[model samples]
Target chain A: MNKSILTKREKEVFELIIENYTTTEIALKLKISEKTVRNHISNVMQKLGVKGRASAVVELLKLGELSI
Target chain B: MIKRRFIKKVLVTSAVLFAFLLMCLIPNNNVLEPTQQLEYVSSEVNKIPIYLLDSHNMLGRTNVAINSKEIDKQARELLEILIKEKGDNKLPSGFKAIIPSETVINSLTYKDGLIKVDFSSSLLDVSTENETKVIEAIVYTLTGIEGVNKIIIYVDGNILTKLPKSKINLPSTLDRSYGINRDYSITSYHDITSFNVYYLSKYNDVEYYVPVTKYVNDSRDKVEIIVEELKQGSYDNNLMSYLNYQTELEKVDYDKNEIALTFNEYIFSDADNREVLDEVISAISLSIADSYNVEEVVFNYKNEEIHKSVIKMLE
Candidate 1:
């Protein structure tokens, strides 16, 4: 996965979204606002030219930003 | 004949107003019939409260009702609502999401009463000042789920031990034990005891109850602490008012499934209207239910059972 395309946080959020954690659970786990989590996902999506959480995750895995 | 008609009209209007006011005072939906109460008891969905920042930037809780009985599912739904720019719950507009936008959850697991949730790293982007509030919102929201007693947070599958900006050390496992909305002003030499309590807040002139975990260094019972907090009024001015200053806790008793509180006449006499009275009942019930094992909170005035709230008994 070409991990350079996404910020560290964005990659982390993308990986988690792919893992199936909900926004609230992510916020609780990371000790940050759910808004920030979404922001990271949106940022990744914007960067990858993708739409939706699952698509971003799939693109990241393909780009080597994430893995199986 | 015209004067008689006018007098009759005035009487009818006043009677209607009286009934409306009475309806306002009584526990409207709370007094549910057995079948309707059963719906809540056997509900497939859970009503979980997610704490968010209000217009004043103080911690305010909004309950999100979801159709999933699974705790993990409920937590996810709550996260979705909490992260949204605007909450999907019935809470009024002034209440805003505390979690920064774009954050997402990776997974949530429960084992032996401990809930472990993994999230994306974007969760680290919250401002330092909101660090504690963010934790409070998360802890309060997760712990609100029954059987889920503690929380362990992770980022990208890695356990988070400290906050990024604030560097606040996190407990390996966090529960209500960590405390929410710390009452730092309380000065005592002894160790502090922390627990969750519900308080009142208003949005659009409608009163909503918010749960907060508070710390006290005193030896008072948890029930007394709840009453005392209510009497102090909400520290946040934007929140609603409750509990007359003179509303003292006359007596308190509790068993495994019930707690009874006797308050001074101020509780009844000081309630300016039914709405305020309902607020009082809710504040008391919701707060006391958090820390105590009791299922019913009985309110008494002058040694008589004035009203009883089954807050804990509710599903």
Candidate 2:
């Protein structure tokens, strides 16, 4: 709802991460490579300066960049 | 009259001697000043980046004096410096040319940011182990020249699309993306990401950087990958990383083509002095310049700015 820090693709990837979509399942659902799925997560994590995907999701929610 | 004539002669002789001495002193003063001599020398020679194989058989970059100013001529001159047979005398101590000694450049043409170099059959004389290194040395050295972004290597007028010994396929146009000192650690062929990371290597106690192009299945951003690998240190015994394993990167922030890294206090070599080792700085800046497009990197410890480095300055 606030200024979005995550890119469109990154938002989609995180939205799926919040839904508990596995990396492989997210890749299949998005019709992208599993590596690409991981890359998206990694990119967002890097922007947020967090170490893991869960932390990234938590930070995004705190920043109001994502909604569950 | 005799006395007067003698006096005149003496005066004339003295006057001539004085003039002769003045002329000699004037010439010495007219000799080129040291500053002027240095300017003349720098004008006639350029310090160009030349990537050469070091004692450990890794490509280490060193600047070599070149006399050419024209782009085409400079490219040929650098290529000559990269050839083992021709460039031996030009190389710095402990460095060797990666190109095979017998290789000969048939022709070279440069236009529109691309250089096409045709080499004779002898170019393939390199051993299988050094085949990729030879290519890397060429690509990195040539691209070091200003305005040269791409290169096309040809053997006898045919595009060299594959390495004869290693059988590694090469694109028709080669650039930094081709990577130097390639190390593959990927689990699967699919979804491979390649990034360049600089590691420190020593020759005769002198430290230099060797860039390794790592191909891994990890899909992390390049900065993250570089930091992680540098922290892991070099797998090769010859290469080393100065980054402390305990150092942790806390946050990455970007603004206006610059990236800032915030790290723990462990990043400093001497916490009391707030000092980061030069080798550590070079390793990080060089790796970041090669992998990331940012023009500057700012190093921070505990949210305080410690050092700022320009990417071009590192290169």
Candidate 3:
């Protein structure tokens, strides 16, 4: 089915993260509220079973889920 | 008319006899004789993980066959296999024992998760380049056995506190914390964090995992560091990572004794088939199992759980 772990918005939020983007920058770049960006990160973390944003980024990279 | 009929009958009889003889002369390819058939006999041979140096001189984990069930016997047997001269024939292709040839195991004693083994002075005869790797192979391989968590080495009855050639300091007691195939990238000794991460390497066509203990100055989460280091791939040409450079970690959520990872579709070798490569899975799972105290790892794509790796199974 070509299923993906993150939605378009969620992936966008993480792509910015790899570029060393902060919550505000990601929110601004994606045109989403800061709260929404945080939520997206939180949702991805919850799905990944990891506790932190950095860990999530690391896991995603290992899984080939996100690109630098 | 009677003579003619008799002659035809004789010819028919002779033809039937010749056909029977030809059939008997031809070998029956389908039926195997009892002696020629293979006998199926089950043995107690077990495949146990043994750490050894590969062709690239990297400490790699591979399995060796042993039939012993007793822990003491198994420990000694594994040690024998780690000695190059003794166990070269026991190893699979592409692996070489790390223990120096002709080094004798003076004595081995195990109790309460600790193993104390004394080796002959010849153990120190390893080249400067392989000094640390020799110790690493011993520590990792011995500790890999269940119920044996630590080891102490003695050369000719004195604790091996230092390497003669490399001059690297050694602790009196050793465990996995001693680290195998280490990579030191720390700027300073202060605030140093050490964690184990696994990378992929191949010998011939067979793929195996190599654990690297990395010392870095960053005090961030160990898992975070592991993923980042893994993403950078391995600096050593012998080692590699299957992680796509573009892959990003979307989120990490931890439950009791388990860590789950959310990733983009790049994690899958076949995204359409929703398949993750075994090499990829082993590289991540082995690294996590070594660094994190988690018993299980759940891999997710979006919200759907794609794969689950039990930590014990990877070992």
Candidate 4:
């Protein structure tokens, strides 16, 4: 909805994050490093023109990229 | 001007949306629909490995006892597997007879020469035949685990007054499952150390056999020690040496509330660290807990604390 693309992995991480996973939880679930999850989250925020976590989540929800 | 308007809108919109979202996600003052609350075997992956499932999957091996301080556990698992795969009769709705879906294995300890297995349950009412089958399943099964020789079963966190007649004889014969016994029966009893068990090499694996003679010539205490040492060395030699266990079971007395445990040695060396002491204490606590009916297992040091490591099993 923000005209930005979400890679498959990023999309997966976002879905989990919205499901209330902490950063470490997401890393464990994906079997990736916590730093890698952070990197993707940063990219997600930048692509959506958001500065931080709350806005990124809100923007994703607004664009219907997420479901409750 | 545009930025100020957008910032105001963002704050107001986020506050309302977040409140609404939070309300939806959290269950608070929500009206409930009439619902059925039936329970199923919890599919939680990290739950206690039902002894039956573990044994059914043939975890560890029949040739050796499971020694991770969980023989009762392994036996319970063996029973559960036998029940699920083998099935049972007169089992109640929530009552499982053979494969105990969940059982808490507190600890197995080897102090002096005696081995103690502690479990959390009251197994007295389990049918006599079921009990005997379960014990034999454990004893025979534990023969495959490490750090166990003879076992005293405990249920509901205490020892029983009488062993159920689900009696299975303890055999020293070489069974290929624990290892191999290609020449097990052929080993000569001569030159066998007093009270020591003998094993013969066969088919690339070790086969165990009780010495042809009973340990009658030695003190019962000494035989108990020899068997425990063999058990400690059963699976991982490193584990046997890790505790550096030097104490002997001096006397073990019990009441419903507490068990009095004594040892021959002071049990720690000048070289040992707190961690070593902790492991030793836990091992003893779990073992003693398994052998008696009690809440606390008091050690010989005159009011020493119950070991914490073994207590963690309760959690």
- Candidate 3 residues B28-60, lDDT tens each? 889756865463533977677889888887889
Looking at model 2 chain B, which ten-residue stretch has the lowest summed lDDT? B33-42
lDDT score, candidate 2, position B261? 94
For candidate 2, lDDT tens digit of each residue in B1-315? 999999999999999999999988774545555653222334688778788989987898777888889989999999998888786667888898878888889999999999999999899988888888888898998887878889999999999877768454566788898788767664432334678898988888877788898866566677888999999998799989999999888899999889999999989999999999988888998888777768799999878899999866664
- lDDT score at residue B303, model 3, on the 0-100 scale: 87
Instruction: Residues B1-315, candidate 1: write the lDDT tens digits.
Output: 999999999999999999999989987566645653223334554566667777657676666567777778777777666675634443447777767776788898877888888878888888888777777778877877777778888889988777658454566677765656654433431334456666776777755666666654556677887787778876666555467888889898876798989887788744454223777887788777777776688888777888888863332
lDDT of 4 by residue, B35-148 (tens): 865534334322221212121112121122222334444444434343432333322222233424345456655433234556555334445535533543454444433334
Query: How far does residue B123 in candidate 1 sit from its true spot (Å)?
Result: 1.1
> Which predicted model would earn the best TM-score?
2
Deviation in Å, model 3, residue B196 alpha carbon: 2.0
TM-score-wise, the better of 1 and 4 is 1
lDDT of 4 by residue, A1-68 (tens): 12225788988888887666789999999999999999999999998898876667655543435433
Q: What's model 3's overall lDDT?
A: 0.81
Sort order, TM-score high to low:
2, 3, 1, 4
What is the DockQ of the complex in model 1?
Answer: 0.02
Residue-level error in angstroms, candidate 3, position B200: 1.2
What is each candidate's DockQ, to 2 decimals? 0.02, 0.02, 0.01, 0.00
CAPRI-style quality class for the chain A–B interface of candidate 3: incorrect
lDDT of 3 by residue, A17-47 (tens): 7666778988888888999998998999999
Better of 3 and 4 by TM-score: 3
